[model samples]
Target: MSTEAVAVSAVSDAQQHTPSAPAQEKTVEKVNLLGMSRPQMEKFFEDMGEKKFRAGQVMKWIHQYFVTDFSEMTNISGKLREKLEKICKIKAPEVVHKNFSKDGTRKWVFRVGDGEGSLVETVLIPAEDKTGSRKTLCISSQVGCALDCSFCSTGKQGFQRDLTQAEIIGQLWMANYSYMEDVPIADRERSVTNVVMMGMGEPLLNYDAVLNSMRIMLDDFAYGMSKRRVTLSTSGVVPKIDQLAEDIDVALAISLHATNNELRNELVPINKKYPLEQLIAACQRYIKKDGNESARKHVTIEYVMLDGVNDKPEHAQEMIKLLKDLPSKINLIPFNPFPHAPYGRSSRNRIISFQKTLSDAGFVCTIRQTRGDDIDAACGQLVGQVADRTRRAEQWKKKIAQSNEIMRSQG
Candidate 1:
């Protein structure tokens, strides 16, 4: 989205102003209070003369417990909690709008701030499995995306700034909180067991903040989630994939929509820069690990099945060869379409045959059922509104309207 297209609920222009710099030096941009990890938060609390373990307690309440306001942490001393409220902010972008799919998927439109103002859009997908063990949250890494994949709505919205670690993690905290208020407390914490960084932005592009957010999620005192539960999906950012494996050691999923260099170059523009060969090599290196059970990592190749495009039996066979001997699985995600996405979902017959080919080749392959499309809350249908003061806002609204109409028709 254009800078002018940022919405009203976002950080305002006044919020972007910087104080005068010290001679010859730039003013220190105030650190975003939300991004700090539990240990880091503890250090800050200690420096402020509060007890050390207070950080752990507060972290648990904020992350696993989903307490946004300090006052809600009733066990914390009123005085100390009040002090925390004043010094740091636990922010959840205001949910200006929300929608639920018949399939039980939820998407919320939230306002996040940049130097200019706040912008919005996010989708939360609850698992549909009757007996599945995991509940997952799909989150946005940017307000909009820079990587304009030919078949993604967020991509067409164009580039917006990367979300800070807090903004990224805040989505989890907010979604968990919202979900908990409706469910029994006994079951709320267990309800959300997985997180996928597959929403809007190119995650590796916003590498540092993404890593920080991952650490917070994996922190035992905070979210206490296993490294295996969180998956960071990327569109082949070859170089950064290694660091993600080494530093975070979480599950990795690649957006490998096409089989060959030609189709991939069109489906994912990044393929042109780091084509299929280099990207596959990166995945191979990522699969190798040197530690205990926790360190043994694997990659998931997320293949979006487009009609007559990359959904053929030959394509599936080629995929098996490409991923041979790697500790990996193939996730055949049927295309979730939006306005101008330029593609259609593959026929069920084609999808089944493709899966059969891979399974016959001794590859672990599963066709993912499409969910949340009715509410525009599926894999790639997340785009939110920006009520600008001028014509640019109108342009954005038109695209959003058109996208929503497509969802309505599909439903």
Candidate 2:
């Protein structure tokens, strides 16, 4: 079947199997306040006949103080707190599983809803600088990916649905609390310094929820992270790239795995629609200066180095020509292996040669060090427990098992 046909079938199957609400009486669910933007919170308060400032006070309590219980919000009036308790909820996902790598990398598997396989994974990588330790949290926007990039394990899981704003930001909420549990309250600010929406799915595909979560990340009453510190990576979603720049100016990273359209079309299926030329043009537009000097940014070109695939010295020369006019840096990622993966990580000598080619051509290039490999939390290796509607997971498992059996027989 064609990809479009499969996607349509999956959507239909999901709707058919979804449980419907009773027709006699409707239950009103309390709003989750964890991911609400300042403006959204203000409007929420306005509906409750409260002043706009009440939203800010409550926001600081939830995000800054990490207080979910309304009674603990000392600054809020008792009557107002009572009202909020009845109408709003600060819900974070339950951490179903946690794993820590020897290199200080931590991964959390969170259950978003009460479904059988509603799990999503988030990773926290710790780094040190001149000041102190810094942690970067990688969060997911969807349960699985619709764009089945050949190189990504998450894509092999197939699409489920887009996460709500609450679910997306809740990952960070839980990560921050977990990382700072032992730190003094005054020193908690160093827990999560940066965030990347490059975890399980294509963030641009779930635009509104992702953007709303980003707003909460940048809010002074919440995480208060700089726009530069938050990044949203896309696998060449052209139109959304334009929309994202207009909506918010967070740093942009493109998953440009291949230098040419033929290879990218095979690796990143979305390239068939947007192609490489349109994608490069979009990247150029994203970094264009409007009025703010801070907005003049450089896009990070992410290239996963697969053995014998798009990692040759000639490929690097082509990349230099392709990105010469754009303000960007190359991030060479070594392919992280999984069961039944079709590619191998490029040898160290091959990677160094590729990097040298780009560097000699006057382009800034940095190789990304692989982390959390032992715990399956590295780049392109996140495959959370998704109740896949497309049945792609079952097919992949069968294929891998068969391949293994055949190899054993031959040996």
Candidate 3:
């Protein structure tokens, strides 16, 4: 059987054997090796009746040497490696699908265990102009998304569950190893230069796992990426934003699709719970606490320009005004349309005009070059799972009918 089919069947077997639970208490069957600090790994070994220092040796083999099998930790005894393998799974979700864009962007689709089994997407983007200076990996925090932002395909998938720390970190490990294996020795780098949590979910909602995964990525013995090189993107989960600053203190990016509250509420539905005023306040605090040269951080506000929606010059002016006096950078992304999404991409002239307004207002604004749209690899284009036709079709029909009734009443 194919790798994807085997993964699906394994998830199916799991669902048949175990019952579902509350969102906060979802059970992840195995611990992954993606997010573990040297100290934490040592503690794990100590708990398992091994010397604490053995954790460091194993961590070196896993993260630095990229060893996939515990038995390959030659420093440890073969009998101990066998015991560890029996009790813990050290591998990542097998890469089931791989797509590369003409612009050196690569996307990998992995099968994650959710109800009936689900999939998640991640991307590795190379710097433009052959800078050879940076390679960034876009990582996902959840299997799918619960935050149904009107413009996002992953949001449309509905919430399944959060990925454990292992799952989150495994993306980096697997991608790094795979890349090293593919490229010539002369062109290869030591590790992924940057990490962005902008792929599939509202990251702050899956806070703990995301933080744990980041700890591993930032640890000196592991990925060791600087806090400035790591960015946590959020759809304005207000309550957790401040805590994120206090805790991990990495680069922060906000998905600010609309300039005002009413429009924002329409685009990113979470704004209804935490409005613009509260969300900006959280950003302000995050900046005051973590923004500086030592941290090497900048608050990036991602504005998705939607035609006749948020692409107006006035909207651009308001965005600049809102962000003024704050240490920030604005990334104006032209909306990338997908099937079933109602919005269209903003016109090129409109996008340029809007960018000019922000730049003229003394804000650092750049238009993100759209990539991988031909293969559904652009922004808000990750719908990882194909819904089970017979079951979800009935649910979709009911949902469409309900929407029609609401629209009829409004009209």
Query: What's every prediction's RMSD, in angstroms?
Result: 7.8, 7.2, 7.1
lDDT of 3 by residue, 1-411 (tens): 432232233333322113323347643334344456565566556656678877677766677677767876777999878766654556676676788888778888877664446677888877844546677899998866777787777766667788866678778887787767765434544567899999888889888778877887787777778888889889899889888877876888999999888899989999999988888888878878834444534689898888899999789877877777667889988887765456788999999999888888888899988777655776335443444222333454477678878999999
Q: Write the per-residue lDDT of candidate 1 for residues 175-259, one digit (tens) a residue.
A: 7777678764335573567888988788899888788888888899778778778889999999898777677678889999988
CA lDDT for candidate 2: 0.80
The C-alpha TM-scores of every prediction are: 0.82, 0.88, 0.83
Best by TM-score: 2
Cα displacement (angstroms), candidate 3, residue 275, comes to 1.3
In the predicted model 2, the residue pairs found to clash are none
Candidate 2, residue 331: Cα displacement in angstroms equals 0.7
Ranked candidates, highest lDDT first = 2, 3, 1
Q: Which stretches of candidate 1 lie over 4 Å from their true place?
A: 1-34, 72-75, 114-120, 128-133, 182-190, 292-297, 379-411
* Model 2 lDDT per residue over 1-411, tens place: 432232233223222122323435543345667777788778666655678898888888777767788988888889977776765678888887888999989998877766665767899998887757778898999988999888888887787888878789888888878856776544555368899999988999999889989999999989899887898999999999998878887899999999999999999999999999999999888888364346346899899999999998778877988898898888999998876787899999999899988988888898988888788886435443433456776787788789889999999
Candidate numbers sorted by TM-score from highest down:
2, 3, 1
lDDT of each: 0.72, 0.80, 0.73
